[model samples]
Structure formats: C-alpha cells, structure tokens
Target chain A: MDFKKITIFAGHYGSGKTNLAVNLAFHHKAQGRDCTICDLDIVNPYFRSKDSEEDFKAAGIRFISSPFANSNVDLPSIPAEAYSVFAKSDTYSVIDLGGDDRGSYALGRFSEFLTDESTYDMLMVINQYRPDTRTPEQVLEIKKEIEDACHVKFTGIVNNSNLGRETTVELIERTREFADECAKLLNLPLVMTTYSDKLEKPNMPNPFAINIMAKDIWQV
Target chain B: MAEKVLMKGNEALAEAAMRAGCRFFFGYPITPQTEVAAYMAKHMRKNGGTYLQAESEIAAINMVLGAASAGQRVLTSSSSPGISLKSEGISYLAGSDLPAVIINIQRGGPGLGGIQPSQSDYFQATRGLGHGDFHVIVVAPSTVQEMVNLTYDAFDMADLYRMPVMILGDGILGQMMEPAEFPTESSRKLPAKDWATTGTKGERKKNIVNSLYLDPAELERTNFERYERYEKIKATEQKAECFMTEDADIVVVAYGAAARVAKNAVLAARDAGIKVGIVRPITLWPYPSDTLKEVAKTAKAFLSVELSMGQMVEDIKLSIDCAKPVYLCNRTGGMVMKPDEVLAKIKEISGGLK
Candidate 1:
C-alpha cells in the first residue's frame, strides 16, 4: 500500500478550500486508508472543521481542533498536539487552514517545522461565482497574495463553484476548465474539483480528483 | 455488543439511530445540527433507507409524522426556531402516542438567534411545548458518545411508551467531533409495529391516530394515563452524573454543554485548592431532582450555570428545598459561558476573593 502524504490546503473565505480538504480526507478514508484532519480554520466560525468534526470521527478518521476556536475572539494558540501530529504522522494528514489572507500569514509561523520537501502540497481553492475573484485575473491576484503571505508556492488548484444545493454538473465542469486555465498559467497542477452531491453525480471525467459532499451527522 | 468509541454527541446520535433500525428521515438544514442531517442523508441511502431534504422545517417534521404513521421508524431535527415550528407537530404526535425521535440542537432563541450554541430551550422543551397539556421524553446528552448511545435508548423508550423522545442538545454538542465506533448492523432490531397507523387488514378494524379526542371524559382519561406514564418515567428514569460531590464545599449544577464547561471549571477549582464539584442532569424532563435534593444535604451552596438567564436555577432551588443558596451564572443569545467565567462565578458564590 502506498503511503498517504500530508496535503496542506489554504485559500480565502468562500474559496472552497475546506470543501476540497474534507472531500480529499473522505476519499482517502473511504479507500480503507487512515486519514487525519486538523481543522485550522479559526476565522470563519460557521463553515469550518468544527462543524464537521463528528462526520470525520465516525469514519474512523482522527481529527484535532483548537479549543474555543470559534466564538472566542481571543483565538487560543495552536495546541502542541497539532505539531506532534504534523511531525510524526505516517498516515495521510490534511491541514485545513482558515479562509483569509491572515490564514496564509498564519502558515508562516509553522515554516520552521516544515522542510523543503516534507511532502507539502499547497492547493489554492477558487470559486468563480464568489465576489473576491470572479475573473481569472482576480483569481491569479488572490493566489499571488496568498503565496506572498505564506512564503510557500501553491502546487495545485481546486475549482469549487456552486450555488448551494442547486449546483449542476455543467457549472462544475465549467469551473474545472477555469481551474485548468489558471493551473496552466501559474505552472501548478489542477488538483481537484468539488460539487455538492445534491446537484450532480460523482462520476465526472477529469484529470484532477473530484470532491462530492459526504454525509453530515448533525443535520437535524 | 460493540466496543465503545470516544465519540461526540451529534455523531453518536446519528449512528445510534441507525443501530435502532431508524431508516426514514426528513429535515431542513440548521446550524449546530447540520451534521445529523448530513450523516443521515449519506448513510441512510447507503443502508437502503430514505433521506429527504424538506423545503422547510415545518414540512420536514410533518413528513416525519407521515412516515411514523405508516409504520416506519423515522425522525426529524432542528435547533431553537426550527424546533418552535416543530412544536405543533410534536404535540400532535405526542397526543396520538406515535413513537418518534426529535433532536433540538439548541441555540439562542425567541427569533433568528445567532448560531453559537446555547441551551435556552430548557423551558420550551420541558414545560409542554404546544397548546395542549402533553410531555415528551427529553434526554440531555453531555458527551458526544452519549448523544449516540441515548438516541438508541430514546427510540426504544419512545416505542415502549408510545411517546415522542427528544434529544435536547446544543451547538457545542452538535458541532464538536470526537472518536466514535460505528455499531454493527446485526446489533439492531426492528421494533414491533402493532400500534402503527398502517392500513388495517381484513382481520382488524381501521386504526385512527389523532390527538383530538372530542369527549372531555375520554380525553381526561387519556391525559391521566399519560400522566401515569410520565410519573413512571420520572420515578424510574431520572439520570444524573455527579462528580466529587462527596465532602465538597460547593456543588455546581449544569447540563448539556454547560455541564462540560462546569466540569472543567470544577477541575480547575480543585487544582486551586477549592472543593467544588459538579452535578449534571442527563435526563432533563425527569430533572434528577431527587439527586439534587440528596446532594443539597451536604454541599454548602449550589451554583447553576446555564446558557440562559436563570431557567434551570429555579428547578435546582425548588428541588433542593432552598436548603442551599442556588446561584445563577449564565450567558444568553448563543453565547456559551467560558470555563473562566464559570470558575469566577463559583469562586464568588463560595465567598472567595476574586
């Protein structure tokens, strides 16, 4: 069996970064491989790893979260357990950073621990429908801003454009094409595309990995 | 029996419902509880079950009532405002004695409250939700694992008593994740369906399930019988978890997510050379009054920490016969009291210098 490498995800809010991270974690876990997720999203309180912690835990996956990560403006510093996991984990680890330029800046603090080739794959999630970066030029600009803040090169792109549960395959495929174009211009790989399962089937043909919504345990 | 897995409350409830043979679900999306819907939507379909995303919470709960009446094990969920919409249906279901499960991942209330977790629904859940005089079995889960475990118990208790069972949770419990084991499919049993409102065959007369009993005497008898069941539930099913109350100077009382915060505060207080303990009520409707009364005999004061202004404090005071000073420490409107806030209150109430 091949070892699952640690994948680091970062992007602005509504960029679909978490969607990519959660789906990748699920995909690997579903294949009977151990996957661990660290929810580092301390910015957006609503749509973060804290909301979906139980779902990942139910899949026999390990999860670590910051205490009072949400609601408390005084963001507690990252716990020591996160560093231990990052340093020693043999299984696939997915670090879901927050959704802001500050999120990128936050990653710079961990640079001392990260090696040049510690299997780091930084994926910048983009959504064409969102206001911050509707056009390709704007997406590129946001990408540069992230890279500058984190001092890390982004290796891939994930297009996660959708209108809530009403998304369709045509929209996903269109976003996929946009991501492909961005990847070509930036010299980065088109890593993945995500769509809500309510809108489209999971079997889309693409060179990149696909991300679909998994079951949430606390829906009611 | 399945091995115990360290699980959060929301995930546990979802897995436990499946283990109890619940297959049909209808619900709308809400915060602190979206996980339960998400879980049921994915796993229910995989298990040859039905999961539907209703347009509104009202439609979702009514759909649950329909499914339950058709002799199917079903459930629906929501938070505070959504639960307010569900109350009409819940009262009807309770009056008709239809067994079903309703989860309230409680948040701040009265209107479209912020999505931060709060337990302000204590009064709404416990003191007869709708117009008629009726009681639903309310279970308070303090841990993620209990959320799963008690859900199974909720379904069984609902069926056995022919009543609606509610798992009252907060956003903290619903959203937080911990390690949990998935129960094997073989451990579940399909509940007997003799009382369901499925179409009656030739051998039996048509069955009617309704809360409207026109005759006053008959309705009164039904009410009395329901009270009898509630009495039995109160007598036999009062659940509480006490930590280090023996020979403690101060006892802190809390439930659900608040209980967890209090537990941490108590630990911190102990570390600081304060003899503070905690009493957590697992069954909210039964209220664990007897236990509180018993603990009041030795403890100097009872500090009530809640997400509301002072709802559960009244119950604590009443239960303990005012033998001890029942103090209130709370934060409302989707705000969860921090451990520091609770500890400060404990110290202040115990006459310690701040």
Candidate 2:
C-alpha cells in the first residue's frame, strides 16, 4: 500500500509487465485508492495491458491507452488523456510499458515528470528464463537500452521470472539467486519477486503475488 | 543445446529459422507477424545471419528470391496484405526453382481487413500464392512449439523440393507465448547446392536461375517437369494429425488456429456422447487427402472448421470425393469461433446423421 505516486513497469517482451501493471492497479483499487493504468506499449502488436480495459472499468479504475488497443486497427497512437496521469496528483498511476528500448521510446515524452525520484519508481522487470535476458549482464544491457531510450533510470529491479504454465515453486526458489545477482549487478534494490496467484507462494523476499491478466488466446 | 524457453510463436519461428542455418531474412513489418522481423533484426546478426528490413514487402520477397537463388537458406514474413504484395516475387521464386521459406502470419481480409487472427488466406496460400501452375509446400502450425519445428523443417523442405515452402500461421499463433525446445541437429542430410547459381570460378560453366521461357513449347515442357516434382511431393509430404478418428462417425477437419479450437470442441463433444473426432492437416497445400479419404470410410459426415467463410471446405470435399456430407463451421473478419460454437456444429451434424 506504500507504493510511489507513479509506478512504471518496464521489461523485456513477455516478461509479465502487463500482468504486473494490471495486478498493481487492482491492488490500489482494493485498498480504497484511486488508480490509473496507462499503457505505453507501441512495440508489441498484441498482448498489452489495455486488453483488460473492461475489467479496469468494472473495477472503477481509469484506463488510458491507444484508441486502437484491443481493436482491429493496429496503430501506436497514444491517447491525449494519457497526459492526465502526470497532472492528477490524487490518483496513483501505473504505466505498463512495452518491451525493450523501442517500446520505451513512448516513455521519453514524460521524462520531465519521471525525473523526480520521490514521485515515481521506474522498475525494470526481468525474467531470467527469457532468451534475451537470461543473465544479469544481459538484463543490465537491456536496462541501459531502456534508460537511453526513455531518458529515465530504473530505480529498482523486479524479478518476475518463470516459464509460463510450467512454473513451479522449485523453479521460483532456483531463480532467487539469479534475481539477486541482477539486483547486485544493476546496483538497484530488489523491489519484489512476482509469482502467479494460481501457484502457492514460494519462500522468497518481497513476494508480490500477481494474477495472470495477459492470457494466451486459447485460455479464453 | 539451448534450454527450453517460453517464446511467442513469431519469435520462436524466427529463432528456429536461425538455428536451421537460415542466414538471410528480408522482411517488412506488419501486424501480428512484426515480432518475427523484430526478433530477426535484434538477434540474427549475432547468430551470423543477415537481417534486412526492406522498403516494402515486394522488395523483401524479391530479396528472398535473390538470396535463395544463391543457395542460401533465406526467409521472409508478412501479414495478409503484405503477403499479397509478395505474391509476384513468390511466383518468380517458384519459376526460377529457388528454395526459400515464406511465412504468412495471417490476419483477416480481402482488402485491408483486421489485425486479428484469421485463416482466410487458405486459398491464397494453398491454391494461388502466385500466378503459377506450380505449388509451394504449405505447412500450417497449430501451436508455438509446432511453429518452431515446422519453421526449422520448412527450410529443409524448401531445399529438398527446390521450391518455396510456407508456414501458414494466424495472429493467435504469432502473439501467444509457449514453452518450446529447439532442435540442435537437423534430421535430414541436406542436398548439396549444385543447382545454385553461385558463380563460375573458371573451373565450371556458369549456372543460371531464370523463370522466363519465351518459346511456348519450352515453357510447357518446364511446367510438366515442375508438376512431376509436385506429384512426388504430393505422394510423400502429406502430413496430418488424426485425433480419436479410429471409430468416430463424424470427423472435424481444421488447420492452424482453427484446428486448435476444433480439437477442443471435439473433446467436449465426445464427452457429451456425440461421436466426434478431429483431423488436423499440418500441410495445407499437400492437403492430406489420403488421411481424409481413410477417415471418410467410417465417418458419416465431416465438418470443415475455419476462420474463413469455408475456404478449406472445398478441399475437404475434394479430399474424400464427397462420399459423405461436408459441412462448414467458420468465422471470418478476425472473429475466431469459440469451442462451444464448434461443439454445437458437431452436435447438429451428429443429429442429422442419426
């Protein structure tokens, strides 16, 4: 309940940032706090946080994303209402950023607001199982690319590593050292290690359990 | 050996192609399938390959033609409209007898349809990928893991047949994430590129790769030769997955994303005491007629489930020579049919059979 005013989730593609963003928004809403989740995903054509717009609406949380989000039109046009995330100080803002540096370019437009350390927490969500970010050095390389593109530094690291559906508690425990190594190498605090709500919670520090929101088409 | 990892279908196909020794990728980005080009751009060079984002889909496919003619395992990918643009180059590749793998991560439409999953390009891919009396080996993958395996195999099939091979996927397959393992070693002994127009080093005569035949007699002769090769492929390369079809009275036929949905429906229908089975064709061009012909011996009726207005239904009818009634269960314009909808169709067909 003590998150920063604006929490931005950025990571590699399919690293579970969209799911974390949705969970964070629900987390804020459940605690009797107003929240707005803005989708800054231009790089990925499918699977964005905006896909849960109806769920967000039913929960009374504000959603801002491309008009083309969840539509037949595949455009990268971010809505003008996304600017309200910074202007409204009363509502907690969660930004679900697209994957990699190209995805982070949309974040560059809001660099002026994100510069203040106290107001925003820019977390680099990393999954060690992903092909591109399998190690601390690889994660760091992405961190630098994202930092360069968005012109904002990642304040902390979030370990959200797991194989989809085949994830086990043992696998989570095995990845603890990898997450710690990433934090150490990046010189950032380990903000949290997320696990799917469907699985039993593993014995890990900063355990943030999240509901899976960005689902495969077959799951429907 | 690379560890099994969770990958989006598009990325998995791109990664598999690289592992299959595909060193050149020429593509222009489009919806759903953009990740394939993006992945190639990010990692292809690291794997000792060339990834070029061409100015247009036409240019990209032509580039594939050029590289493939030089005996390099090359690839190009696009969505529905972009694939249409590349059709001319694809025909040229076939005409020139070059080997290349073309990926169509299908979206809806005749014009600029929708940016969602679709199988409407079934006719375009199987029957008329280009204006040619030739054929491209069209392989449709239902899962991301299959996307990996089929993509790795597509390159080999292209080379083995000395023609183009297609990996026909839909937006759902392109975007979904699944755990996939990459093959470390190829199963086939690839034929040497003696037919490649690599060059003359003064030791041998120069080889030429061309599609133009001015004389009508010469063109007809070449067409006959190509059809003979096509016949060989038809005999050997027809692949399908028959699920619970041994004693079923109603067999459902589908491919790609629609097949995945139809399989789920078939399972549900069987549980509900409706005798139903699914026949999923892995290769659309080869059509897997023999498998359907076999199933038709016992099946009272067949349902051709699709994401189009029944394009594959014609093939299903022809596959079995219309011995039994063939029904179409489909959704078009980016709308995918639900499992329940397909189950209802199976029930209707079963009721009529009774």
Candidate 3:
C-alpha cells in the first residue's frame, strides 16, 4: 500500500499499467486519501485508463481524462488538471501515461513541472509476455525511451506480467526472477509485482494482489 | 527436433523465415503485426542480413521485389490496411513471377478498421490480393507451431513455383502464446532461380524481370501460362483437416483462429448429441473446396464460421455448387464468437435439418 504523493506509470503497450493505476487509485481512495487519477493515454485509442473514469469518480477519486479520449478523434490535448496534481501536496496523484514513445511524447510537455524527480515516483511497468519487452535488455531499451521522453528517471519497477484473465498464479510466481533481473539491470527496487488471483502466495515479495475488471472484458 | 519455446505467432513466423535462409526483409510497422518487423530488425542486423523499415508498406514490398529480383530470399509482413497498401507491389510480384514471402497477420478491415484479430481478408487472399487474374500461394495457419513450419515451407513453395506465398494469420494468433517447436528438418527441394535478374556475366542471355506485357497477344499468352501454373498448383497443393467428419450431420468450415474456436463448438455440440464436425482449410488460395464437397455429400449442412461477415462462405457454396444449404455464423471487426454461441447456432441449424 506504500506509494509516493505522486506516482507516474509508463510502459510498453499491454504492460498492464492502466490496471495497476486504477487499482492503486482505488486503494488510496479507500484509505481516505485525496486521490486523483490522470488518464494521459493517447498511444492506444482503446483499453486505456479513462475506461475507469466513472468507477474512479464513484469511489471519491478525482479523474482527469484525455481531452478527446474514447472518441474517434485522436487530438493530443493535455488537460489543465494534470498540472494541478503537482500543486496539491496533500493529494495522492496517480498519472497513467500511455505506452511506448508515441504515448510518452505528451509527458515531455510536462517536463518543467517534473523538476523534482525525487518527490515524484515514476514506476516503469514491465510485462515480458509482450515480445518487445520480453528481455531485460529489451525492457531497458523501452525504459530508456520513456525516460528520455518524460525527462524524468524511473524510481522503481512494477512487474505486472500476465496474459489477461488467463494468467495463473504460477505464471506470476515464475516472473519474479525475470523481474528481479530487470530491476537489477535498472538498479531500482522492484516496488510491486501484481497478480489477479484471490489467494496470496507465501514466497512472494512486495506482492500486490489486485482484481482486474477492465482488461478481462476486452479480452473476450 | 528443436527445443520447444513458447512464442507468439508473429515472432515465430519471423524466426522461421530466418531459419529458412531469408536474408532480406523490408516492412512498415503496423499492429497486430509489428512484432514480425521488430524481430527482423533485431536479428537481421546481428546475423549479417538486410532488414530495412521502408517509409510505407508500398515501399516495403517494392524492396522485397528489388531483393527478389537479385535472387535473394526476401520477405515483408503487415496487417490488413498495410497489406492493402502493398497491393500494387503484390500484383507486380505476381506479374513478374518473383519468389518472395508476404505474411499478413490480419486485423479487422474494409478500411482502416480496428486493430484486433480478424479473418476478414479471406476474399482478398483467395480471390487474388490485387488486380489481374493472379493468385498468391495463400497458407492459413491455426497454431504457433504451424506459423513456424508453414512460414519456412512458404519460402520454398514461393521459390519452387516462382510466385509469392502469403502466410495468413490473425491478431489472436499473432498475440497469443503457445508452445512451438520448429522442425529442424524439411524435405522441400526448391527449384533454381534461373530467371533471376542477377548478373549473367556475359556467359548467357541477360534475364529480365518485368511484369508489363504491353502487346495484347503476348499478355494473353502470359496469362495463359500463369493459369497453367495455377491449375497445376490447384491440382497438387491443397491441404485441409477434417475433424470428426465421419458420421457427422453438421460440419463447420473455418480457418485460422476461427477454426480453433469452431472446433470447440463442434465438440460441445457432439456432447449434446448433435453430429457436428469441422473442416479447417490450411491452404486458402487452392482452398479445400473438394473437402467441403466430400463432406457435403454426407453432412446435413455446413456452417461457415469466420471473423468476418460471410466472406469465405461464398467459396464454400461455390465449391459444392449443389442444392445443399450452407449457413453462416460470423462476427466482424475484432469480435470473437464464443464457443457456446457457435453451439447455439449449430443447434438452430440442427432444428432446421430435422
């Protein structure tokens, strides 16, 4: 349940960052924190953070969706409320950036606001199931792209590896070494590894059990 | 036998091409098909092969043409819209009688459709991808392992026949994970590329690689020659799988991902005491039309299950050209039909048959 006052999520497409962002936003709001979820996803038109906008608002969390999100138009418009997340020191802001270099360019425009990288936590989500981000070197290559575009360093890693609802507990358990290798390569803490299973395993380190409602429906 | 590795269909296809000694690849990135290009880019550089991302799909296939003209094993991969963009090059390749491989990891489309898995390109593949009376050797694969073996064979098939070969897969196959063990051995003996425009060094007549036959008589003759080859190909290179066809009433005709889904429905319907089977076409160009006719003789009806609205069903009906009724069970634009839904359709058809 530990998180920074402001945490930014970014990764390759299908890395499960949106699911994690939504999960964390709900977690903080449930704990009675002033949580705000920013959906800055313009990389993919579908399966984005804004799909949970009504859910986030219903749970007493402020939601900032992309200007033209969920529409046919792909205009790159960053909402003003995205910048205000930085000003509110008492609020727990969750920024769900889009996948890959195409989605991260919008993050660069907010470079001036991210001058203090120490206060804000940037979590690079990795899902090795995706071919492009399958290896630690490939993960580093993608990580570098996001870092260069966002003009901020990633403080930690989140191993949110799964193949939708078909993902099993053993698959999440098996990915720990791969995630550890990637964390070692980046010299960052493996802040959390997510699983959708209801039961928690004993040997899991920094495990975050979550319920993924948005992703499974789309897989169907 | 090579060790088994779980690979996505797109990645495995590219790897299979690499093993088949395909040294040149040109592509433009489009999903659910970009992994093929990405894999080529990552490996081709290290392996001392040529991998170039062209400015567009049109340019990519033209690059394949240039490489094939030089008698090098070449390839290009794309999705539906990107493949549509490469139509000109595809026609040119067919007309020139060049040997190359094109993999279409299909997505939903008539235009710029959604980027989800679909088998909507059945008509484009079987009825010729572009203009002119031509056909590519279209091979539809249903599994990741087949993605490897079929792609490897597609190169040799393209060379043996001096024609382009299309490996038709869908988004689910492209993105799904499954265990695949590429065969270390293949018995396909490829023909020589004597017609290649590689330099003759003044030892023989200079070979020309041209698609344009401006003279009407000569063009007609060329078309006649191509059709002869097509007829021979039709006679020889047809592959299909008939699952539980014996003593079955209803047969489901599908290919690629839809076939796998339909197989489940077929089995489920059988448990419910319906005599249902499935006919999966592995080769789409020289489609398994005869198989449908053979099944049509005994079965009550045939259901054409697809990810598109009644594209391949036309081929099914034409294949039989009979009085037996043919039905369609389809979903378009990236939606996957559930097995239970397919079972319901089968039940409805069974009622009609009764």
Identify the leading candidate in terms of lDDT.
Answer: 2
Residue B280 displacement (Å), model 3: 2.6
Compute DockQ for each candidate against the true complex.
0.04, 0.61, 0.13
TM-score of chain B of 2: 0.99
- Ranked candidates, highest lDDT first: 2, 3, 1
Candidate 3: clashing residue pairs, number: 0
Deviating ranges (above 4 Å) for candidate 3: A12-14, A22-37, A45-93, A115-119, A127-138, A160-178, A196-202, A210-220, B1-16, B29-43, B107-118, B143-146, B171-187, B214-222, B260-273, B333-341
Per-residue alpha-carbon lDDT of candidate 2 for residues B150-213, written as tens digits (9 for 90 to 100): 9888998999989999999999999999888898977877889998888888878888999999
For each candidate in turn, give its C-alpha RMSD to the true structure in angstroms.
Answer: 14.9, 1.4, 3.9
Query: Which residue pairs in candidate 3 collide?
Result: none
- What TM-score fits each model? 0.66, 0.97, 0.84
- The lDDT values for all models are 0.76, 0.90, 0.84
Worst 10 residues of 2 chain B by lDDT: B182-191
Tell me, by TM-score, which candidate is best: 2
Docking class of 1: incorrect
Model 2 misplaced stretches (Cα beyond 4 Å)? none
Pitting candidate 1 against candidate 3, the one with the higher DockQ is 3
